[model samples]
Target: MQSQWGIMHGTHTTPVGRVRDGALDLLKWLALLSMVLDHLRYVGLSLDGLYVPGRLAFPWFCLAIAANLHRTRNAVVTGHWRYLGWLLLFSVISEVPYRMFIDDADTLNVLPTLALGLLVARGWQQKALIDRGLALIALILGAVFSSQLMFGFFGVLLPLAMLLVFRRPWYFSVLPGWVCVAANQWQILLNSGSVVALTGLVACLIAPLAGLMLLQYAKNVSPPAMRRWAYALYPLHFLLLLLLRKALA
Candidate 1:
């Protein structure tokens, strides 16, 4: 199956001198913006309406992960380990800020979910038994701790779904799109039936496909790269928001 990005099946050739993808950076920035908007709802303001756009954040982030895995499909294992390591490190580092900011937080911060999702996506892309085993373990953990995961089990599945349709037709993204909705508690949104809740539901349903379109067609116009240091932003944002909330009070 050939794609516009030249994805060849059963090809083991590593890309040479791979340049950074600006579209990915753009996606990351947009995701970060959406996340900030979502978190802003907690800033002692009556901004509940922001929830609609906020629905886009997590799915876009999962798309970024899928893009990264697709790009590094043939890279060395050490590099993949490094990626997972940063996520794990920040998962621990970010917990305090996450708890401090979020009221009665029931779930771990989002990074652990992403880290597990990464393992699952890697399992799908790789032929290694260890990778597959790790992915299985991740799935089990996601299942066992669904209540303790920010987006729950479906969130852990979203990245793998994104990876499956990464370079495929745009319509294929609906799989992950629905997964995104499920992860965000679509049933509750549906039950609410308010305009904002409905809008948020729609946003969650389409976010993955929309993000995929951006990745496929958006120009790589030298957007800022989101690197390892970007991990700090997750925890830092929570702290900043806590300060903002306190100041507003």
Candidate 2:
């Protein structure tokens, strides 16, 4: 009999030894769709329900980061600078559009949180002086100015936590999810948050676990590839949404 954990090994095989995980790709597409729906709420849609699904977007993205790190562990030896560089560049590129698209977005866009999280994840893996130093500095900056960060320090730490528990059981996500809840303003939301807010909050907590389940369970589903072009979609979506908002307004 085949093992139950067969999905972890992936479905599609390549001669080059790299297996393309259709489930992972599907999760990415779902994440993208959720993000778009969340952003649409701001584009003059009275779709408050979108917020619930939107909550899944960030955590799923973080899980993707952790998954990518696990898949490309080899990059640790060969400098992950290119990965950092791309994120950093897009962080800069996305800022203006993010500010323009979102109302009063005083915080820096989400990419910085992700970039720092990547560094933190890497540090967790190797704990090298350089990796730890960079992660430390980024963490300090995010902590000192948490308000100016999209997800704040704890949000930046989430991906690293996810990375640490990448291969662990799905329930392990709850451990790091507390940090996620706190980073997402749990104190304020917990008391007065409505049904939607509370549901979204719960979704935020479980998104990683859910995403991991999708990766390890959903088999034989091929979603489109989300490659370098997908990075451009971040800023492009902001622009497109801003245009739509202008039209709707």
Candidate 3:
């Protein structure tokens, strides 16, 4: 099928050049902001009702990853490696603050999960046995460490599912949406009576379509700066939130 980036079948061309899409950067910033608001719930806003906004964070990040992958007309391998590296680096850096900010949190935060999802998507895209095997290992690790703060095993899987259905059709997000619901079942059910739950459900259902639409319709946005410090934002933000929460307490 044809997409804004041109034809969508087969492997992306090699040595892909930079594709500037500002909407993605904007979305990333929005997602990050939403995540901060959500984390604030733990700090002192449990009654303030910002959790729903926070719900947009993970899916948005996943969508950004998928959008980046889709836009790279070539250099799939380089893109995958670079993405994986960034995720890994941030995963390590973000762990301490993630644990400190979220009481009793055990997971390695979302970056690692995203890294795993990147592996899964890259493997699926490349059709390589080794990559597939690595993806399975990552999935297993995610499950074993499910107690950790980030989305756990299911969280890791959500992005892969998102990548799978990307650009296919609007209806494709349903399965992933169900998976997302299952991943956060109790919370979803508890929030069901309220608009938050409804919106969360709808977001999961439409995330892929929304992401695809953004990429296709909003490709004119500038790409985010891919710098080392950008990754640090994850941990730094957590620390800042932690300090603010402590002060408020």
Candidate that scores best on TM-score? 1
lDDT of 3 at 90: 81
RMSD vs true structure, all candidates: 2.4, 3.3, 3.3
- How high is each candidate's TM-score? 0.94, 0.89, 0.83
List model 2 lDDT by residue over 1-249, tens digit each. 222333334333323215666877788889888999999998987999898898888777887887776766654355367778889999999999998899877789899998988888877776579988888887887789888888788888888877766656556778667767777887766786699889878987887777877877776788777777788899999999999989988
Mark the regions of model 3 whose C-alpha exceeds 4 Å error after superposition: 1-14, 186-195, 223-226
Q: What is the lDDT of residue 224 in candidate 2?
A: 78
Q: Which candidate is the best by lDDT?
A: 1
The CA-based lDDT of model 2 is what? Answer: 0.79
lDDT score for residue 13 of model 2? 30
Candidate 1 C-alpha lDDT tens digits along 60-168? 8898888888877777777788989999999999999999999889999999999999999999899899999999999999999999999999999999998888556
Angstrom error at residue 137, model 1: 0.3
Model 3: per-residue Cα lDDT over 54-133, one tens digit each: 66678778777766666563564665677788888888888888888878775567887788777766666666788888
**Residue 61 in candidate 1, Cα distance off native in Å:** 1.1
| Candidate 1, residue 183: how far the Cα is off, in Å | 0.7
lDDT of each: 0.87, 0.79, 0.69
- TM-score of decoy 2: 0.89
Candidate 2 residues lying further than 4 Å off, grouped into runs, are: 1-18
Q: Can you give the lDDT of residue 11 in candidate 3?
A: 68
